[model samples]
Target: MREYNVAILGATGAVGTRLIEQLEKSSIPVKAVKLLASKRSAGKVLQFNGQDVVVEEATPESFDDVDIVLASAGGAASKKFLPEAVKRGAVAVDNTSAFRMDPEVPLVVPEVNEKAIYDHKGIIANPNCSTIQMVVALKPIEDVAGLKQVIVSTYQAGSGAGQTAIAELDHQAQQHLNGEKMTADIFPVKSAKKHYPLAYNLLPQIDVFEEDGSTHEEWKMVHETKKIMEGDMNSDAVKVNATCVRVPVVIGHGESVFFEVEDSSKLTPAKVKELMQNGAGITLQDDPDNQIYPQPINAEGSTQTFVGRIREDQENPGSYNMWVVSDNLLKGAAANTVQIAEKLVEHDLVRVPAEYYGK
Candidate 1:
């Protein structure tokens, strides 16, 4: 029943604001809340649990006396400020990709790998948006039949790119309606030389392409999945590959996941439904008779991961396919971070590990 002082880095952005809302609704004992952002966002007032809190520019001193920090800032900001937070005795859960691949950090989805938090060296990592929902939907299957491979094709929302990309989609949609030439700036990659309109179209690229012809987002899903689902960082036990696409939607992200289990006999649609029926934070919406399935529009605001369109792959005996949907900002980023913070308190493991000092 002890309350802890909490600091939220990047308190004004999309995911940052959702983090605040999740914290407000979470069961963590919050003694005091601090809102930290960039200088441009400083002095902006936001409500938390009905009280107005002004955003402060984040710095090393901002983390003083903070017990927990929910960081949704960009990689640079997380790389810059999280160590300071840990140095000042705060256990931070990061939403950026900064520490997810780090051997020292635990890449977690609460419903899937919550126990891995026990090994955190002060900073726990939230996995990629697509990876988070995929793992959550797969946990039930992994419990029933061991996982061997994960192949996901994501129809992600423009919001996944950021707040600006959402607005770009809106503008382009209107432009298309008016028959005006839609402008392109933020689709494939912000820094890429060529850009494309994301309204009423799909871009197969999420992040920049690597030399191997896979986007960074795809690589993240491939590698991060292996790390989160395996105790061995380099384990090839579970194979993961992703095809990421940016769709016209605004909030929720949808994934078509094809997975192969170790034992085919243990899992069928009925048995998968049985496991999902008892799974934590999972919703089984599979129904082919009346046309029921998970959709991004129906999943926008909720943090729960929805699964539907479950069926066995005709081509492969041991593989199955399902549709997974969740709010990209909530379940994928903000709510997941809050869940980790709650686990930290519940397990009484909030202090920084000694080995992580000056690291």
Candidate 2:
């Protein structure tokens, strides 16, 4: 087995921490794990493969001896250092929106489009958390029935907003129980003038709204779906519209998805359930008679994308309704990035071309 040196950027953030945990158990031979973060977080000790590694300030030089970089440090950090990683001869699998929409970057879900990994221009973009689970659930169906359109609404967890948002939820919940006034400093939109309490509350907006009346979070799902599943640069074949809401849950995201297919007569909800039961990284939990369906509370800390509530749409012949759930930080971000790195090693997709790294 060939050994690869890996670097993890944003080592302190929620998804970044999970990335470290996943990489520790990864099949790829990780020769060295370098944890990189902001200046303030430098010297922070994080354990990887049972050894404590001190976090370092992120810089172009950070990738000097790195072979693969898993970055979850947010879009700004990815935009700054991902190219630098590439220039220094490391392939960056970024968990940020910075390169997701770029025509050159592949928005990948390994189950749906692992082949996209071959096309990376040294940096590969992971799909949005919500988008990842949905596509994983829908991919098998799309292969069988031929997808036409997707309409999805997400019940996203507070943790998706990051650690501060999770703290805000805890603060608000405790305050509400004590009959004290609740304060929210991180949620909906953290920089917006007003923040709403996330405990026992639903905020229709996840990210700031754009001019098209869709919030940026919603638009990520919309555009990312088309890119990952359909691979449509022209954006004409697949249609997607998403409504993203922030819920009080701390880990998993639940989505209610409605999709239309070309061959409705051959497909049924039962067949879909059977397909999901045998699909990779997916579990079918749709036993409505026993009162079971995919729920966020049951999905925390798990890598599986859970699907349930498979039924035909009432008004549309070729359409079906389903529920999708997964840990936003695991299968959605870190696990997907790690899976790509494993694929790269297994396939020998991009070998360091003749002294490319001056190795």
On TM-score, the candidate that comes out on top is 1
- Predicted candidate 1 versus true structure: per-residue lDDT over 1-359, tens digit per residue: 77899999999888989999999999998999999999999999999999999999999999999999999889999999999999999999999999998888998888888889998889999999998999898887876778988888999988887778888899999999999999999887888999999898889999888999999999999988888888523335588888999889999999999999989999877887777778889988888897889988899889999998888889898899999999999998999999999999999989888887346
* Model 1 misplaced regions, further than 4 Å: 232-236
Candidate 2: C-alpha lDDT? 0.87
Candidate of highest lDDT:
1
Runs in model 2 deviating more than 4 A are 232-236, 350-359
The TM-score values for the models, in the order shown, are: 0.97, 0.95
Q: Score candidate 1 by lDDT.
A: 0.90
Model 2: residue 137 alpha-carbon error in angstroms: 0.5
The whole-model lDDT of each prediction reads 0.90, 0.87
lDDT of 2 by residue, 1-359 (tens): 77989999999999989999888778888888999999999999989978989999999998998999999888899988988788778888899889999877778888988888776778888988999999999888887887888899999998988877888899999999999998888887888988889898999998888999999998998888888876723335578889999988999999999999878986887888888998888999999899999888899888899999999887887799999999998998888889888888888754444333212
Candidate 1 to native Cα RMSD, angstroms: 1.5
